[model samples]
Target: MRQNPERRTALLDAAIEVLAREGSRGLTLRAVDAEAGVPTGTASNYFRNREQLLVQILHRTRERLVPDEATLTGPFDTAALLRDLVARMRRERSVHIAMLELRLEGTRRPELQAELAAFHGAELSENIRWHQDAGLPGDRHEIVLLYLAMLGLIVDDLTTPAVLEPYSVDGLIDAMVARLLPEQPVN
Candidate 1:
């Protein structure tokens, strides 16, 4: 018998909730099944093992956290986009923490590491496209560096909330624009 799409989505949602609440170390198929109010066999039917379940949860997270393709196009407000991205990080604090924990776990697991790298590469590609549409110079390599730096700043701000109390996401965007864009010569 085929599983219901809604039930599958519910299971994934429950998995994320469990991950956010318990961190990677605490996640288990039994726990997810319990959280979803389903039988253990049901959860097992969908995800044969813990690793498969984790990969699905991470993939769902990427689906939720990453902006859609339409939103990446130009003619939209770049500052607003940056603010939205920062706000997403702030709002999904638990998820972000869980992701960090999973990343650390990935160090010992080559498959998980490769999965994360692919996700990062995709994010970098989208960011590069956004910058290119905004008339920025340099290739994907330069753009990826800038993207990683921006992510680092956001993560730093989140980790040390007090250190950047006065700085807003807008300020970060301004700094990035200043560094990445060339100044026009005064006429």
Candidate 2:
């Protein structure tokens, strides 16, 4: 396996693009190498097998989609946080699409399913902890509700944006926050 961090990251990023564009069935090492404009065997050097590649893609997707530190610097404005999150997701549409593809693939592959379930479980715990640390006015249940609602909104926005055209995305986010965290006044 290669030891170049930059090359490995590049390969994983290329894999993300391939996954988004080709789905799991089409995510071959050659596809990633071509996507990265690298030599034919470069991805194989970085990842031993497709499962390893898929798992690494999950980590890369999370890294790519994390909230910006600047957005986390102020008071716990749920609407603002959600708005920033949604904007990031929209901007990194490929990352989200790749992630969705992995999720669908997970349904058919038990190992991938376990990996995704573990990743999501940890992420959920982190979100809850972050919300508490930020003094956000919501419990775990509310947080989970907001998470589900936002996930649905994001899926719609990314895959079928026209479905949400009648209402402004920001407005919808605001409404979702207001409804979910009734205690926190919507911004």
Candidate 3:
């Protein structure tokens, strides 16, 4: 019922921390309120229900994780771009973990599943368009594969980093980029 933009954003950010710390089963309105340090019913005032909360969190996570425009539009090659992406993910580790939580939760809720699918599908399309428009060395299909590969890399790096203990994240990123995109000369 409240329409304060700053308060709503604060609540959503608190919810993200809750999801990251407690996982989906522990994400309750009370937990969000506690995390936000707001009154008991404050989150309820901002979000109509758990589903709405989850949806809003989804968008908020994307907003938190988006790379800077200069990083994308500046003169950079495909490998550099991928490295910047990995760095961004590492910098926003909690947000990425919370996003992973949402994805797992989506598997159990059909409506949430649809939301995740549509959101990620559109995101993938946009990435492909950006790759082409930016003159990155890769086709749509390659970009799609790269997306899938990086997603796996991200999961490993975030959830169970030990699984990749043998190789650094940057090394894996270089390997993935090499396989997915044509070799570009360094400037």
Question: Could you tell me which 10 consecutive residues in candidate 3 have the lowest summed lDDT?
Answer: 72-81
Query: Candidate 1 lDDT, tens digit per residue, 51-154?
Result: 88878777877766877676666666545666777778888776676677668768988998898889767766776786777764546666666677677877
In the predicted model 2, the residue pairs found to clash are none
TM-scores of the models, in the order given: 0.80, 0.96, 0.95
Two-way TM-score contest, 1 vs 3, winner: 3
Q: lDDT rank, highest first? A: 2, 3, 1
lDDT (Cα atoms) of all candidates against the true structure: 0.74, 0.92, 0.90
TM-score of 2: 0.96
Model 2: runs farther than 4 Å from truth? 184-187
Superposed Cα deviation of residue 180, candidate 2 (Å): 0.9
Model 2 deviation from native, Cα RMSD in Å:
2.4
TM-score of 3: 0.95
Winning model by TM-score: 2
- Residue 173's lDDT in candidate 1: 80
